[model samples]
Target: MRILHIIHSIDPRSGGPSHALRGLVQEQVRRGHQVSILTTNAQSAEPWMPDDQFRERMNNDPAFSGAELFIARGYGRTRPVARFTWTPQAYRWLRRRLADLDARPDIVHIHGVFSHLTTFAPRLARRFGVPYIMRPAGTFAPRCMALGRTAMKRWFTTLFVAKDLRLAAAVQATTPAEKDELREQFGLNNVVVIPHGVAGVKDAQTDAPAARRALNIPERAKVLLYLSRLTPKKRPDWVIQAASKLLSEYPDLFTIFAGPDAGAESQLAAAIASSGLNGQVKRFGFVTGDQKRQLFEAADVLVLPSQSENFGVVVVEAMAHRLPVVVTPGVASHIYVDASGCGLTVEDSVDALTDGIKKILQADKTELGQRGREYVRQHLTWIVVSEKISEVYAAIIRNQRTRRRNRSVNQQIRLTTK
Candidate 1:
């Protein structure tokens, strides 16, 4: 099947949605499906100035090798305006593809909401009679809706997004909670639940000693890792406070904070200083590729106390590395953790988070990690997820063809009767 994905940006720093899209696209291409991506050249570091090197690397990245990529020049530097990502070139490119019989996509996959790409891509797909699936990626969740320019988002949804979502061939939700949010917000029944997938980890345990040495962490130390964007919603400060409580019990405990600072570094720093965990907690801002893998290898457990997470990809990634997780109920993947018996799901409070971390520290971590790895292998790998997504795409396309055929048949009968 020919699939086209439309997203605002492909930059890794743009967070989970971009990374999730990359994983899905790569797997789809490997399965022999033709895939193409249309996105703006918008980087989180400098939105107005497009990074030529980043685009070059992405084009050459092995993960995206079999897919066609189109990156249009984007406008707007500020957060609010930047999201609207004025990319006239993307509009033109999509228009041409939809008009060409050979170049037109079998289906279009639109990611995220409240972005220029999401706002306009579905409209074009509908205009060209192409079935399009909308993946909200948790934008409609109550917690997400409360963040950043709520009024503007409200207006945008009412003016444009509502129609686009309602007209989509299907709206994908990564978890049942997200599915509920979509249904509640839109009063639509076309929601489909499909979780994000993670790549398998190889020799993560064998590499732990070397990973610890490289990071200057003692082999005997018990490491707790916070590996997501340091945003306020993610609540990295909660991790710091929780760690402070465990120091007396676990004297050799160390905490590692990974990922880029997204407006929460100051709070995290203050928490570290106040708790006097300056020596115990280390911040490795924005790790990726090998560095990220090493962090997973070195850590005994992973914690993500986000106020709301549509799907915590890093949690599954940690599980793939045989690292147990402690996440809040707000995390959509907490259900998987609970069901798989891989980790604990606690309330969104410092005391609860502290107790949850303590339980993991007190239990057989190795066994817990093994459970997580097995669960991910069985149910959350890219191979499993991509197949489910492919099925959805195929079903939507088949239904669309049936509808068109019926319309054509009815039109012919009317003409013959006349």
Candidate 2:
């Protein structure tokens, strides 16, 4: 299958959608499918690069090997417009590709909403008689819609996104709760639920002692890891508050805050200082590759106290690393954690999170971690997720063919009658 993906940004620092797209595309390519990506050169706060350099970097990057990448220079560097991803070059490139019979995609997968790619890509695909699927990637979650330029989002949806969504062959939701939100909020009935998958599960389990030594962490200290973008919505402060409460009880307890500062770094730093737990808590900004693996290996439990998450990919990553997780109800993966009995799902409160952390610290961590690993091995691996996504693509293509046949038949009958 020739698959095309359109996303605003594929930079790892941008967050979950980027990481998810990388995993999905890599798996699809590994399965011998032709995959292509259209994206802008938006790498968080970094200065935008020219298209040629961006393409060269992406093509050479081992993470995206075996896939064709198209990069366009994008504009805007501030809030509201930062994610707009206005790329006329990408728009023109997609238009030309759709117009070319040889280059036309069998299916186009558009990721995220409220962006130039998501808004315009679907329209182009439809114009060329190609089917496309929309994956909102939690953009339509109630909490998300309520936060960050709510009025503008509502306006954009009504004027452009709603029609784009309605015309999509299908809209993907990473969790059932996100599906429910799509149905309830937008009245979209074509939503399909597919969870994000983790890659490299077998190699995820690293040597804990070695990792601890590398990070200069005490071998016997109880570690709680908060690994996600330090955005306000992620509520890193809540984790800090919860950690403070548990530190005295578990003197050996250590908390590690990892990931890029999205907006809440100062607040989190202040919280840590005020709580007087700065000695017990450490902030390691934006870890990736081996450093990320080490953090996972050295941690006892992963904690994500987000205000909302359609799917916490980090939660699954922690699971893949044989690390038990403590997530709040706002995290959609809480259902899986609860169902799999791999971790604890606590209410979205500091007290509840503190107690949940304490419980995990007091409980059999090795057993809990093992259950998480087993769950990932069985259900959350990219090998399994890609298969399900392929099925969805095939089903949509088949339905499109049937619709075309019916249209052809109806035209023939009208011509005969005339």
- Positional deviation of 168 in candidate 1, in angstroms? 0.5
For each candidate, what is the lDDT?
0.89, 0.88
Q: List model 2 lDDT by residue over 1-418, tens digit each.
A: 9999999988777888988998998899999999999998877744455657766767787767899898877887677787796889999999999999987888999999888877889998988999999998888878888988899989999999989888899999999888998888778889999999999578434699999999988899999999999899999999888877887887888889999888888899889889867588877977888999999999999999999998999999988888889999889898879877878999878999999989998889789988888888889899999999999999999998899999999999999999
| Candidate 2 global TM-score | 0.96
Q: Best candidate, TM-score-wise?
A: 1
Candidate 1: segments with Cα more than 4 A from true spot: 45-50, 201-205
Q: Against the true structure, candidate 1 has what lDDT?
A: 0.89
Task: Report how far residue 411 has shifted in candidate 1, in Å.
Answer: 1.7
Clashing pairs in 1: 259-286
Q: Provide the lDDT at 392 for model 2.
A: 96
Q: Tens digits of per-residue lDDT for model 1 on 30-142?
A: 89999999998877643323378878977887768899999888887677788888888899999999999998999999998877777889988999999999998999889
